[model samples]
Target chain A: MENRTAREYYENYLKTTHRLGRILTASVLILLLAAPYVIGIYLKAMPNIPAVLKAFLGVGIVYLVSGIVEYLIYVPMLGAGGSYLAFITGNLINMKIPCAINARDIVGVKSGTPENEIIATLSIATSSLVTIIVLALGVLLMIPLQPVLQSPALQPAFENVVPALFGAMACKYYRADRKAALIVLTVMTLLFVFVPSLIGSTSMMVIPSGALAIGLSYLSFRKKQKTSEGGNEA
Target chain B: MELLAELNSPVMYLICGGIILFVSVICIVFAVRAYRAGRQLGIDESKMKRVITASTTFAVLPSIGILLGVIALSGSLGTPWPWLRLSVIGALHYETQVAEAASEAAGIGGLSIANMTPEAFATIAFLMSLCIMWGMVLVIFNGEAYSRRLVSPSHPEKGGKKKKSGMSGFGDTAMTAMFIGLVSAYIASYIGTIVSGNGMFSFQGSWLPLAVAVTSAAAMGVFIYIKNRTGADWVDSFSVAGSMLTAMAAAIFFGRLIG
Candidate 1:
């Protein structure tokens, strides 16, 4: 009975979330396109369409693929509502993903559960709101804050945010499964060391490294199952 | 400079600000709905509050990092556009790259505010806005279906019992592995810099990222230890933020020392 209630609640939640998400995201897309259009009309400065397309073709093609890849890779982890919010807000790797992960861990919610989805959505929405506020504040204070924010002394901090963040966040997960973590880390490190040019392709690299880790983990799970079964037989 | 100033005009701010305002409203609605759903799900109000607090805290430094992106791009793209872009559906790196490309294509000679024209500005804005939007578009279409697959049962048998999906069993591990993969790649890239002497920071400053990472990791370890030992709930909320700050401070310290 409790299961039925929970399932019904989740189904309704997804229904509402998807409906809202579609409308909101579609509206956002229209607004985004409208920005350039409105600007072009106001200034009577329409861009050369061919040139824009040509240039976009060069870079947009790459980002288009990356965007699709990121969507597929991230949507599962982010869940339904969180994906809508996070994808729209951007900064997934450096901010929203970590925020959601941390929230889930702190609240002790398992992934793929309705509770986890709610927690992820709440956390991502809060993060997005905070980000918008911060960006607004920074814009308002860009003059006064410029020197400190752009200072060479403080530059390293911003530059290393990825390492700083993932190091700490990854350590928790690494601790959860040390063997898989160590093996994957070693393999990725070697790959990067050998083909340093591949550094720029880290997003794509998530595929191989993830597969390797998952493969190792599955093997471990099977081995553990076998061992337990043997002990049961004994 | 005049063209650049024109690009930063009040109309531009209004357009950008309006979009940002809309996005914020969406965020609020979603957050409220999610919160209510949590209540329906029997989640403790205290826990939901903690999630909000933690997410807000965790967001500060990174959002500031994004602010730095805006500031960097403001010199070229003007304050309003960068502000709007970074505030919604724009990443720091991608915005910079696409804006540069668009600017070059517009004959602005690659992201220079000096020779900017309205046409070039429009081009940059269009390309930057349009290029990275696939994620959102795809999500609009497929997000619900994909999410359902993740949590729903896969196979139904003759007895009317549904078999558990592979995603439910392996989702957590896959997510963890993806994170591990991401971190390893980043850490490895930094390590590569140290070894190859050919990457972004150069050999001299190459050690900085790795050192900062270790410091952050150690700070995280301390936070976890404190949380475990003292049963302090706030420690969990603050661990990532605290560790990031510590690591950033270490970066400055080590940066100066190495120099």
Candidate 2:
């Protein structure tokens, strides 16, 4: 009876999250377009439809695929409320994802639990708010901070932010399953070495690498199970 | 450049500022809801506070990186638009690429402010706003269903008893694998530059990124060691943020040494 009550609460919470998520997302979408439309109208310089379409065709088609792929790949990890806020606020790969993952790990919450969902949402929300505050500060201080921010001496640090971030993250996560990590890392390294252009497609590559790791882990699990069974028989 | 001046005008700032304010309010609302739900779920208050503090710390450096993106784009796209783009749904690289493509397609010749007109700005804005909006749309319509499907498989609520499928930890393993795949690909590409003598960065063939990554990984190792030894919970909270800043600082030293 307690389990049933818990299940009902979880279901109701998800239902409320979805309802709120859809409404807020739809509202934000309108506001996003409204920014450009209001500007165009205010300036009395509306966009030419043909030119907009042409420009969109040049890049939009590719990003359309990317948008869909990113949604599918990231949503599972991000959970419900987290996904809604994250998609709206953006910067998933660099900021939101890492923040959510770190919070979940720190609190020792398993993915797919109510605890995990709440943690992910809290972390993502906090990250988003921080980003907004930072960006606002940047805009206010752009003049004073321009030289420091745009200095040649600082370019390397900014350029290498991804490596620095992921390096630390990888260290933490790889310890969980060293064997799978080794196999995936080696295979990915070899693949990149051969087809260097694939460097640009790291997001898409996660699919195959994840599948390979899962397969290897499953095999290891089976092997251990069989070993225990054989020892019992002996 | 008349339009460029107007683009950065007070009205533009107001619009961008308003949008950011709206987004911020939503963030606060969600955060509040999540915190209440967490308390209901019996999460320790201190743990949730730690999550908030750690997330705030982890966010600072990356947010600065994004600020730099705004600064970069502002040279061509004006301050307000780039600020809005970076603060909201757009990334640095994507925003740059799309703005360039839209400007060129609009016959503005590129992302040069000299040739930017209202019409061209409008074109850029439309393309930038339209193309990236699909992700939000997908999340709106499909996010709940997708999340339900993802969690139901492993959820204890779905099955009253835990199943011993020998696949107990696969979700975490998969997440870790994806991250490893991402980092390895990045590290390998940097190494590949050394092998092929061609890379995307100006300092091609230099071991800059790989060296930076190694230094960062070492820093992380040190943080983890310290956390284990001292039993300082704050070390755990600051590990990633501290490692990233240390590695970024070391990047300057490495850049000078290697380049």
For candidate 1, give the lDDT of residue A188.
Answer: 81
DockQ of 1: 0.65
TM-score of each: 0.94, 0.93
Once fitted onto the true fold, the runs of candidate 2 whose alpha carbons sit more than 4 angstroms away are: A1-6, A221-234, B152-168, B197-204
lDDT of 2 by residue, A104-131 (tens): 8888887777878888999999998998
Q: Which structure among the candidates has the greatest TM-score?
A: 1
- Estimate, for each residue in B1-259, the C-alpha lDDT of model 2 and write its tens digit: 7777888999999998898898898899989988887776667999999999999999999999999889888878789999888888887658888888899899989999888888888889988889898789999888877887764443555642454455555566566666666566666666766555374333356677777788888999999999889888888788889989999999988877766
User: Which candidate leads in lDDT?
Assistant: 1
Looking at model 2, the pairs that clash are: none
| Alpha-carbon deviation at B30 in model 1, angstroms | 0.4
In angstroms, the error of model 1 at A85 is 0.6
lDDT accuracy of residue A70 in candidate 2: 79
lDDT of 1 by residue, A33-116 (tens): 878979999878887788789898899998888898888888877888999999889988788888998999899887767788
For B1-259, candidate 1 gives per-residue lDDT tens digits of 7777777789889999999999999999999999998898788999999999999999999898899999988887789999999999888768888988898888878788888878888888888878989999999988877777665332122111343422335567767777776677677766766765475434542788889888999999999999999999999999999999999989988889877
Q: DockQ for each candidate?
A: 0.65, 0.61
